[model samples]
Target: MVDIRIPRLNTNDASYVLVEWLVDDGATVESGASVATVETSKSLEDLVSEHAGVLSRRLPAGADCRPGQVVAVLTPPSQASPPPVADPGRPEGGGTPEAAPVSPVAMVITAPARALMRQHGIDEQDLAALGRSLIRRSDVEALLAGPPAGVSPLVTPEATPAAREGGHARPAG
Candidate 1:
């Protein structure tokens, strides 16, 4: 099935409105068909079908669409609708639900950190172990690297420069 998504119409708008759909849901149309009308801040443009197939509309006529967001899918004439898959946000590990809050306080995740989390399938439960309300990319990396921050398996106090330089074990009287 080919995904029918809104294209990047302009640089200024972060999202566009799906103004209308020219074709009905599950309608069979030829390639290059104008399937929907999308509205940007500046213009209303046609959304086209990439292939000749049966349209399966995912979003209604009036919906907000980000660039590359799949608003519809086109199943080839011979193929049946694709089987539903589990939500990506939900972990396959049979663990906590995706929306479970890490803490009572709001957690602020940096954009890069969020991207890394998605890429690595690291959810809030994994992040909650971090005990930090603010999550950054380095924190995620440290978690991915097999140890939490500041607690390295390799380095000990004896490995420190001060310890190796013959510093007193206790303060001088």
Candidate 2:
């Protein structure tokens, strides 16, 4: 058996988000395969499997995983057992039936977006209104802000926050 750990992608983030699973739990996977994705503060990195075996997923997509945490295990096919479920009473897959994906394909709400939605008491139906392929933290914030920017209130060059604060507009490097 092989342990699939969550690597420390950056120095700043203590925990990372499991963006999505590339393969299903208890499925066979090849060595060096990207089984899932870990989302950091700035980017997402693939969680590669070091061993080719039957995958036993311990964490679901969209859950928080910390560095050095075992998120899955790879068992040699000959010795592979059923993916251990925390709850024997539960079905083969983890999570409640209501925990199904919002859509069959595309449109994954990042952890930050989920947090913001919870904080603001926003509903998933509200986000469904956006009809985006991917929903990020910024998208949720924009929804909370209401109306499209530059629709009702357009800040003039002179009235810009930077300008008013005596800071000039500078290109980001």
Candidate 3:
């Protein structure tokens, strides 16, 4: 079984609130799948699964989980059923008839797109200009070619010509 710990979002912080589970309790998940979402002081991030198996939630939604704490467990397929737990904050490892996975947002993006956004400092509005719900690296590249006519450039108009060539434009004062 693999322990899904709350990752340390910052060096000075030790805890974060469990926002919600992307996958339902007792649901099967693949390695690197985003199982849960957590919120720290800085930002929110998905808690990914390390192993492919059935997920067993160890904490309810909105619980304060510390970094390195086991908030969930993964049981292999052969094991099937999750063992029962009477803990108030924890749920029995099995599918809950009432729970459903959270639906993704319309503009949900792939990991590569997110990485490109971070690297290029591209904002959501920039991607939205592409007129595509799913953002891709090539789409970002196209935007980098320069904003469409009549649209405000991602970089500030006052930016040095050299900065514009780099694809990052600072907003004018």
State each model's C-alpha RMSD to the native: 17.2, 9.8, 11.1
Candidate 3 per-residue C-alpha lDDT over 34-57 given as tens digits, one digit per residue, 9 for 90 to 100: 998876665677898878999889
Best by lDDT: 2
lDDT (10s digit) by residue, model 2, range 119-145: 655556567767775688898767656
lDDT of 1 by residue, 1-173 (tens): 89987899999989887767789887898998899987777667899887899999999766788998999998887896654555656657654444555647556565557676666556666677677766767887776666656675332335333455765223212
Task: Give each model's whole-structure lDDT.
Answer: 0.72, 0.76, 0.71
**What is the number of residue pairs that collide in model 3?**
1
Instruction: After superposing candidate 3 on the true structure, give the runs of residues whose Cα lies further than 4 Å from its correct spot.
Output: 82-173
User: Which has the higher TM-score value, candidate number 1 or candidate number 3?
Assistant: 3
lDDT of 1: 0.72
The local distance difference test score of model 3 is: 0.71
Model 1 pairs in collision: none
TM-score of 2: 0.58
What local lDDT score does residue 66 receive in model 2, on the 0 to 100 scale?
A: 96
Segments in model 1 whose C-alpha atoms lie over 4 Å from true places: 81-173
